[model samples]
Target: MAKSQKLLTLCIAGVALMSTTSGPTTAFANDLPANLDQASKSANQLKWVRYTDPAEGAFSMDIPVGWQIQGGMFRFGYFDVRWMMDARSLDAKTIVRIFDVNVPPYTLPTRYTGRQGQPYSRPQQFQMMVSRYLDGQSYAELYAKHRFSDSCKIMKPRTSDWVPTLPASWKDDPGGRGTQGSVSFDCDTSDGPRVATVFVRTTVYPNGLWFAAPISILSTPDRVTLAHDMVQHMIDTWEKNARWEQYQNEMTKIGLDRIQAGFQQFMQQMQAYHRERSAAMNQQVARFESQQSNQAQQVSRWGETLTGLQDVSDPMTGTQFQVFSGPKANYYVNGNGVKVNSDVSPGAGFHQLTP
Candidate 1:
């Protein structure tokens, strides 16, 4: 159960961290009205551009003018990023991000005690999941590591109804039940103290699969209200492309199949390599043992040869003598003289003899 909780936290952290990077997306609609008067009519009335991802067609979103859009891949699938203005210190920046959520294969214990030791109700369980996700340990570590903030305080999330625009075919989908909520908080950051408001919309399918879109806005205290209003406007204009979603599902299946096949092939190669390495190691050990045996025999033969030599005394001269045989020569030592006789070659010395 603890492992499952950690996995859930990690998956959520991955999603949140991935959101910080930009993703793949297209430009605004070409047919948008170019007139300045029409663009300024209202925040919602601004000229909006529609972006469609070309790879899996998994994501589509409409971005307002003066904002930048970037798209990229995530573990679950693809994500889309849209942001307005540079987030310089003392300046306000609004960033909106959308990504899919995939719960790993496991069941979270529905009934768990909270930090207060009180058992959480079903609704509270869901809320706790969201709370823990937004204030993930990874997120906090990132802020600290980069000196982005001194600390963070996640406010209690407020739950509300959130309906996502899906295709007609998806209306009766099993996990079609949807919910929306937002969490607001303040942090002391290196760039200056800033307030962040995050909005999340989640749809849980009948099969237990779920998808989430979390939009975050960061700004100075004075501009937080304006940033909040901008976030609402962006949400109001948001729409999803059903065709892209279908394309994404098909492409994802194909990609997974390829990955599985590649992994199987790699494992086979690794096993064959291991077998060859083991055989080689065994052969080397055999050679080493044979060499050691030969060395021991050589030492035994030398010992026997040395043992055969005896000390001898000549009575007439009272001279003590011993003879030793080496691989190339024999040596005779006594009180009178030291003599060396070579079986193969002889050198001139005090007492040298040739074969």
Candidate 2:
């Protein structure tokens, strides 16, 4: 525990020296507690209860009670599916987040058809690569910069001893390999300086396709110690519904088959377009492919945007809690976080939420 706090301290431990131009970002820390364990508990003591997935009870994880929650699954046109959830303290200072597991894939740009530094093979399912390969630290930093501040100059950036729940056979497979990386950075927020830590995993296949997911991110005030055990509890207590997984797998296969059929039809259309010398035909093909590329970005952007949830006050009590959103539905909640989403208001104790 002492070693954990050392890395996140205001000054670098054991360095004993200074140099200019050390990193790209820098921020100061506010004085908090010296003891890591006590600081974490006192600053953000939590009582966790299992929260099932709202969209489908496919999985459930422990979440701190009384905190605002907004998490669900994302399904885009049957080609891809992802799940993520976030829990934040009432003050909105401390936060924990989960990321999508099955995002799009990408390959290196060495091929002749490569553009934007990535190969065009399986263009509908593939995205342009910014690099041929990236290790855990690189991917974590990449995501942190994208989701947080662009300048994270203060980073104890290195691969961590953290282990992922991916099947062990993945590492043993000849065609693929997996890795884990973690880093802690000092962030300068509007209120004060805070420490943001990120953990990421990556898998690469023999065909050059790669998938990297920043699986978890936690941010707390600079002086407050991270609830390492709380984070561990969330991971250890994760429960997956077996029946849901089986049904999901069958549905996923059907989705993949549909995607394959769509790809074949797209190829035939492209061939027809090529056979014709008309400019309009070529324009139509360009529009179709461009839309696919945009879809990937759109899905990714939606995941990033979920981190922002508005606080809504309850009339029964003076306390405010974050509300989950749905299409054309209004949500009302009691002090305990139980909610009802409907166009009409609930009983006398409930108040309507604008968000």
Highest TM-score against the true fold, candidate: 2
Error of 1 at 280 (Å): 2.3
lDDT, residue 179, candidate 2: 66
TM-score versus the correct structure, for each prediction: 0.40, 0.52
- The 0-to-1 C-alpha lDDT of every candidate, in the order given, reads 0.42, 0.52
Q: Which stretches in model 1 have alpha-carbon errors above 4 Å?
A: 1-30, 35-56, 59-243, 306-355
lDDT of 1 by residue, 1-355 (tens): 3433332333222222222123344443343433434322344455556554444343445555544444533333222111222111112244444432221211223334334323222321122232222222233233222322333443322232322343342232342455555555565555566665555544443333233445455655665554454445544544445664464444434544554567789999999999999999999999999999999978866775768643444444565655454555444333446554445324443333222
Predicted structure 2, TM vs. truth = 0.52
lDDT of 2: 0.52
Q: Tally clashing residue pairs in candidate 1.
A: 11
Where's the lowest-lDDT run of ten residues in candidate 2?
Answer: 10-19
